[model samples]
Target chain A: MTTASQLTPRRQATRARLLTAAAEVFAERGFHGASVEDICEPAGFTRGAFYSNFASKDELVIELYAEHAASLRQAIAEVAAQPGLTLPDLLERVVDIWTRDPDERRRWYLLTTEFALHAVRDDDARRAWQRLQSQIRKELGALIESIAARHDLELAVPTSDLVRLLTIVLQGGLGQHLLEPRAVRAGALEREFLPLLVEATTR
Target chain B: MTTASQLTPRRQATRARLLTAAAEVFAERGFHGASVEDICEPAGFTRGAFYSNFASKDELVIELYAEHAASLRQAIAEVAAQPGLTLPDLLERVVDIWTRDPDERRRWYLLTTEFALHAVRDDDARRAWQRLQSQIRKELGALIESIAARHDLELAVPTSDLVRLLTIVLQGGLGQHLLEPRAVRAGALEREFLPLLVEATTR
Candidate 1:
């Protein structure tokens, strides 16, 4: 087996392309509906190329989750590093990133929901998903704590609970907005609900 | 063609059984993965019986949404009729009805998510789903108005905005709990988040 260090940059780019293609095809055709051939066709890669990078579709999904999470953390860090950024500004920036691409957002939402349903039934997948979720919660909790300290805001609840609530609102709002876009509108959570939550939690 | 009034009680019961079974099977296998035969087998009905009750799976889904919404309204009415119940009590009671059966709740969540995804792509389905959602929001707004009046509570936001926020929180919270049951817990909305929302909105 070729070690990670042994892989050339060109090979790494091929793997990344395949993963991105898999995400799109899976979102469009669903996990069970989309075949490896379908993903390969769109990405201009062969079946062997897919297998060389990931073991199976399930493995690809886990990697997709990791990639998405990493980018989100990077975005959060970028926003946090801005000078004189308030809680609301940070939230709005993050929401902009999330709601920036409606098509991509919808695709991601579909894939995530599909994976979540699958994870609930599969023990190993659920454990892996939960680990990622736990890490996200920890990162969010730290960010919220830092914001509270920077603003001298008194949090009404634990930082963990606040993070959990934020996750719930985002997931829930996205689901609703996706289903009823005209009513829920894009950025409803960031524009309306998030402010309410922040104000309620902070004295 | 049989008129609605011409149908006997037995026919009505059969229709109800088929719907309930469809909800369960659809939840388990999803809209695309499930077939008419699968739903009929569990409900002990023939394909003819299934077709007689509903034209297609999409039609049955619309019916399921109507039935669920009707039952939710009934529950809200029952709760509202209780003597001397405060807003929090009513909210808690409603949440109880929602979170009462985890299996059923999980099934509903899965089916709803599936339907929502389907609706995004189908115009007719989206309109039908939106009508039901609008009615639900209106009913909720009315309920909140009455509660505020009875309790003489001053709302921090408009009644409509509050209703919308409540829907967001419920949808958001359910999505989180479904994915991370151990961390979020069942009824975390009713027990933890709803109270905070009520406190935030009311003085």
Candidate 2:
């Protein structure tokens, strides 16, 4: 439960490196496909270093998602803080940042998908995932509501549902893109339709 | 390539039984977890019978998806063909049939998701899935266009995008529900919001 900031600077560096390597390995090989040794080699860390930071690969993934959410929240906040930015511009910028790293987007999507399937079948995994997601989802809902309020826009549905709608589009869009990269552009669904949806649903 | 009707009645029965068993087993254990022997026992057949029918588990899954799509299309058509049905009624009926068998719905979603992950990682699996899905999506688009036309409605986007939208919502909603059933209802997103999405996106 120790926060990353609580660790010694050297320990913090090690933790960050492990997460980076884990994300790449898991995204490519999936949750079950990649071994602990596979991830450690890329991170330039020993098994002892990995164990010192996180209990297991599962715990590392949880931390990875949390870090992703925090960074994305920060990015959106920075954009929203810009003076006199119109709602349309804010929406566009948000989408741009979200889609900025297609490689990382695919990584997060693939890894989360593998985690989600595991959560469906295992209670321990479900509890850990649900705990992380519910907290993340609540924070996201509040962030979205504040964004809408700042723009003087009223959404047609609750902010929670709006957040859920966005999640739906992200998963669906990325998955279709995964299946047919040549046909569907990465992030095209959420990028194209979300703005239109927001305009129609907001006043 | 053999159609069900092309077989003798007894062979047709055996094929149907094999499909039923495969769906149940795979849904519970996933694509990789379920063995040929596991599927055979429930179908009251031997491993020899399975090989005679399907080249592999992968081949069986492709056929499973085809049959599911075919039955669902038929169900939608039957409902659409009913006389004097209003647009709202038609929408409701469609959602009802789609959500009618929650067990089977979960089965389809879980199994297809596992297969999709495979398709993402492997080119051969990707081609097999893409071929089936492209054909299915095209027919579904045409079917949807005819439905909209019959109701004298004009969609804001192309029917193809609308079909994609429905898929995104279905996957997003179902996956969320799978993660937290106490919070989100099955088919609720597509059931409730799809109607509104359609209303706003159509004229």
Candidate 3:
């Protein structure tokens, strides 16, 4: 009779190892290029253990997507909640969060560009992706409202449009990193984008 | 003798048929999925004919890229040359050129996302894509300069950054179209993005 409290630390360690291995394998070989054997070997696990933990590669990918979406939400929240921060200041913080974390960026670019396509084509994967993106959209929409209130600004466009642009720029920047990594200076995006963003909101 | 202008009307029709067929196959099935057989089938051409016309799929894709890039240049040139147009009017023209052309948008999105990845992974393809993009950047940069001059606006940032942003948004908007075909409203991009453009360039 295994109890909830009785789950072994070894199990947690193995789960972490599998996730790290998944991220690495997915990054290098891609979702299609990397096989289950490739991922398990990196994590020092056998096929049986891999199956025991994750039903399949698809299942593991879904879990990773959820995890990443949650963390992104947290990052945005951290920036948005900063006391006395202006709209541009908060936007800059969001840019900093994305560009500064290389590991996060790597996993994100891979999942969004490569894996997300597969998800879009597959029904189950597409639903999961929609759910994650919906959560992100909700959080971002709220942040936009908060900023508008704090700044006493009415956006020339809808808030949804603003959030959509931010997401596109963030994803485009990540994809660009995969192609030309050197161009992704940490503070460069905010420097270039914030003034325009402020104008859009204030107008 | 196979003189430069000696091609018969029948030969010209065949060439046009092959090009049209190839475009459809590339858009619907992607570069990999659309084999020589698939393209030739739609055109009622044999493998020998396909080989005679196009040395390889890579060459065919390069030609498509060239055509798309050329059309974009023409669109930008027309927009920039429009006399007595305000900045907002110029931007509206740019957005229309980008989003309203259905066939061009389909081919451009497919090529940029899937075909560009194929190019990035292969040195030969990378060179071909780079050449196309360089041509595009040069034309866009020139058009931007013309617009700035007409408006007497001294940009705070480099014109190169504006071009980069435009390229990223074009690709990103196309990407969004794949998921939600109606996401990119024709005039809305100009409306939302022009304020930012003015701010970046004006003061």
Candidate 4:
């Protein structure tokens, strides 16, 4: 029998392939439209392999959800930790990740838009999404609280509301982006956005 | 032959019935899940009536979209006209319509949430949504700019961004409302939210 470490490279490659394939399938066919077979086909994997790795399509969705959240949090965390970085810098960086690449951002928007409704219908998926959102709120809230302390701002809205506000703006930008991406792409969305947040917090 | 005024009342009644039925069906079954038949059944109308009044499901959706937009603008117009009304008052009123009827808001949220994606997929629906949103932005922006002028406050963001930002927050709040109507009640949500918007408009 092959040891776990011995198969690490292969496992890593398969996982990456599966995720990439899933994202493509999910974007093109929507969450409900895509099947496990469609996702696996792109990855050159069989249903058995998919099942072995993930219990079901919902499970894969949860995993992908977690990955995207983690990636977002990580980017924010890095910016938050960067030396001498102003709030403007952090905000711009955050917006760039989502708005910089149209194709990537569109795919991300599709996933999020579909998954939100999917979670609503599926109890297990809803729980998973709720957990992910809760965690993000916690993480982001802490970051905001830290920033508030540095800036000496007393927010009228709680850090959680602030997180919700920013998240909504970013998500809603996807709707606007779907309509007029060029308009949003031209300006500094979060750059101009953070000051309002800063002002609200101070008030 | 139906005279313009004579047709107006009948049209209004039919429109009301259609909107009410559509809202109910959309709330229950989502945009894609609910069909024109679902909406027509509750309104006591046949496909002929639906088709006569509206070309397709998208047409019906656009009508509902227009109604909501008109209602919102009317609300804002009333509050905006109130002499010496503080910015906070306007914000409160804006938030109130959303939280006015908890049950109704839940239904509205579900319908509106589904509409965004549907708008993106359907051209006619997308144009309808964009038209309404543009009108909302223009009207809301004018109100915001007026308030800023009267208050002698410098908004950190432009009026368009302010309207877009508020719209997004409202959308997210509605999304939350959909998921946990009882938990995230209107009063609890509006508590700090109003101040946040008002303060953002302040210098």
> lDDT values of the candidates?
0.78, 0.83, 0.69, 0.71
Residue range A1-203, candidate 1, lDDT tens digits: 23335679988788778888888788778876898999999778889988988777777787787778678777877887788987778878888887888887787777877788777767777777887778777887887777778778888887877887887677777877877787778877556778778887888
Q: What TM-score fits each model?
A: 0.87, 0.90, 0.76, 0.84
Measured over all alpha carbons after superposition, the RMSD of each candidate to the real structure, in angstroms, is: 3.3, 2.5, 5.3, 4.3
Worst 10 residues of 2 chain A by lDDT: A194-203
Off by over 4 Å in 4: A1-13, A145-157, A186-188, B1-8, B42-44, B76-86, B145-157, B180-190
What tens-digit string does per-residue lDDT give for candidate 1 at B134-202?
777787788777777777888887777787677667766776787778888888755677877887778
Candidate 4 residue lDDT tens string, A47-116: 9988776777877776777677777777777777787877667677777766666676677777777778
For candidate 4, the per-residue lDDT at B37 reads 90
TM-score of chain A of 2: 0.87
**A20-131, model 2: which lDDT tens digit per residue?**
8888888778888888899999767899888988887778888898899889988988898899999878877887887899888877877888888888888877777878
Candidate 2, B1-203: lDDT as tens digits: 46778899988888889998998889778998999999998778999999988888888899999998989988998899888998889888888887889888887888888888888888988888888888888988888888888999987887777788877777777788888888778777667677777776788
Best by DockQ: 2
Stretches of model 3 off by over 4 angstroms after superposition:
A1-21, A34-62, A79-92, A119-127, A147-156, A181-190, B1-21, B35-56, B119-124, B181-191
Best by lDDT: 2
DockQ of 4: 0.46
In candidate 3, what are the lDDT values of residues A1-203, reduced to their tens digit?
12224568988667668888998888788787889999999678899999887877877876676667678777777777778997767767777777777776765666557665666456776565665566667777887777677778777767666776777766765555455445445446545765676675565
Model 2 ranges off by over 4 Å: A41-52, B6-10, B41-48
> What DockQ class does candidate 1 belong to?
medium
Check candidate 1 and list the clashing pairs. Answer: A172-B172
How accurate is chain B of model 4, given as a TM-score from 0 to 1?
0.80
